[model samples]
Target: MRNNRAAPPWAHRWALPAMVLVTVFFVAPFLLNVRFAFSSWTSFRAEITWNGLENFGTLIDQDLLANAVTVTVLYAVLCMAIQNTVSLSLALALQRTSRINTIFRSAFFLPTLISPLAAGYIWRGLLAPDGAVNSFLGIEWAWLGEPSTALLVVAFIDAWKWSGLITLVYIAGLNSIPRSLLESATVDGAGPWTRFRRVVFPMLAPALTFNVAVTLVGALSAYDVIAATTGGGPGDHTRALNVVMRQQWGQGFFGSASALGFTVTLLVIATAVPLVWWLRRREVAG
Candidate 1:
């Protein structure tokens, strides 16, 4: 008879190290920061006092807070929709075997390899008043200024830079579909759209879930690009929740920033949980 170990003994060895690292790096700092959110920092020693929910109440009463929430939601929805749609379309277009497909796929993914911050900086130069975009169009438009275009410009940039990454993910999902199922659908006289709707789409739900969730998170957390481009606006027109939180930090309102941080974290988890539940429910139902 062969003797089997009860679970892997090595798991116990790694558990302690993992817990220690997480505590040292993540959990401890997060708790400390949350404490800061409730306390004030002065010139003397780092003093932390219990301030109840004053920070949160103050944030809620600010106009900037309202604008930040609205803009953040708009950006998240638009960017996720556009990025996912365009990316999946491109992935579908490139799924075939051809020299053009290979070349196109490489071109599509190239933008994603560059850091988001770097891309924002590069775009800052190109979208300036006399930059190439407006120059080519023969009109001087404020890509980063003016309330009308500031948020739109940032949203567009977010979509352009990140769409390709989601495209690759979709491509992986597409490729994993069994060719036999597709062929069988074809033989049954199902049209291309029909096959995609009834068969291909369902199989890609997991990938779609992943892509959309990440895109939403990225959009909500957009700071570097907006900061690099318009510095949060012609006049805070494009300010997101993250931007507001950072401004609080800059003002040495650590307690307020920490409160905002916790708020944002909760908001993210709140949105993600419902989305994941719905997607999983549908996946199961179908």
Candidate 2:
């Protein structure tokens, strides 16, 4: 009953080292942070005290958490929707290889190369009253100065910066489809829209899964952009969960911030699991 196949030599050689590295770098620190999440601090980051549900209780009492959750959900949803749609559309438009397509592809992808901090600052200036956007439009609406528009503005900026990467992912997916299948569809009297609907869209599920997951993670992890642009204002209207965590950390609420971070991690995992599963099912079904 004990028939055994020998493992590869490389696996035996490297597995222990890899496990050791992971435990040292990731597992150890993660356990330490989990400990921090349940522990309390006194004075200005002075002394540590173990507290049972006190931090969670504090988070519940802080009404900002509710606002942060709402804003973060809205922000993540908008980013996911707008970025995925625009990117997929653009990828479809530029699927074929050509000089024009190449040029546009580079241009579209340029924004993703910029640091988020720089992008935030760039958008901040553009949204200012006397900035280029207002100057070009001949209107003086303060984009980041009002709670009504600030969250939307930040969400849009986040989408604009990241959609290029999503587009490229979609393009890769599009490129993977065989020309023969598309030609056959055309020969069989399939219109452009019909072919895309029946063939292109379904096959792009992998890209959709990847893009959705990445953008969801990116949108949730948004911090430097908010820090540089709004600093969780127009009166905390644009404050995402990560921004709230950072602010909490700054105010020396380490346990509360850790709890918020853990919540965010759980939320991302929950959303991503369902999304990836749904898209993958579509792939198989299609």
Candidate 3:
């Protein structure tokens, strides 16, 4: 014979605070943003009147939306590529456990703990025309003032800031692989590169999926680093979608800013959904 009893009320109440916080903070703001995106809310106006699609139309006419989209995609792509490359290299190099590797991992991860804005400001100072970087190289160049190089430089810095975390993820993935698999490959006379390409790489599909998706989304939503470093300057060469939204907000175009934010949300969803699906498929295939 068995007896059944429902859980205590307190047992289910544990999640209530988290649910309330999520509704109040994330869900509420998102709904409000959607509503504002369809209205005419601005600092110059006392009333927020419905103006369906007007804000988006105006942005489209001005070509600001296209430019922001292009810049944002470019920046995201560059960051994803650079961060993953650096991270994978570091993970491979430090996969072996040792005191030196531990020290190096800690040192690399220290940058991840710093505020993005603060890191940008630090990089700003270092990349100035007469800054330490130029002095050390014995040459002067305005790193942040050049249109062609500013975006890439900012992307590299963003990658530098996050590579540590991604490296740790890769290291975790590497350690999870069966040691016998690597040893078998070695006995089969497979070289390091061949082993990685044929065995280790395929086994790391899940980690690659997580790292790539995260890095792409983070880069798409990047603002603080670009703001502190270039402020979307050098003629808007590095102006991400968020930077453009901030500019719109500053210019008393609240509805337009909200529309831009909504667009960013849409872009992220659209991009990430397909990418994650494709990555998951690749994981299965691997």
lDDT of 3 by residue, 1-286 (tens): 6544877778669989999999999999999999999999989995998999999999999888988888998999999999999999999999988999999999999989988898899999999999999999999999989998899989988998899999999999999999999999999999999999999999999999999999999899989899899999888899889999999999999999999999889889988999999999988998
Over the full model, what C-alpha lDDT does candidate 2 score relative to the true structure?
0.84
Off by over 4 Å in 1: 1-7, 40-45
Q: Which residue pairs clash in candidate 2?
A: none
Instruction: State the lDDT at 48 in candidate 1.
Output: 70
In model 3, what is the error at residue 182, expressed in angstroms?
A: 1.2
Q: Candidate 1: deviation at residue 50, Å?
A: 1.6
Please estimate how well model 1 matches the true structure, expressed as its whole-model Cα lDDT.
0.82
Best by TM-score: 3
Ranking of candidates on TM-score, top first: 3, 2, 1
**Which candidate, 1 or 2, would have the higher lDDT against the true structure?**
2
TM-score for each of the candidates: 0.90, 0.91, 0.93
Put down candidate 2 lDDT per residue, 1-286, tens digits, no spaces. Answer: 7645877677777789989999999888777667766778633766777787777778779777788878888888887888898899899888888999999999999999988888899999999989999999999988998888888888888888888888889999999988899999999999999999988888888888899888987787777778889988988798888988887888888888877787677678888889888888878998
Which candidate achieves the best lDDT against the true structure? 3
Model 3: weakest 10-residue lDDT segment is: 1-10
Query: lDDT of each structure?
Result: 0.82, 0.84, 0.93
Off by over 4 Å in 3: 1-12
TM-score of 2: 0.91
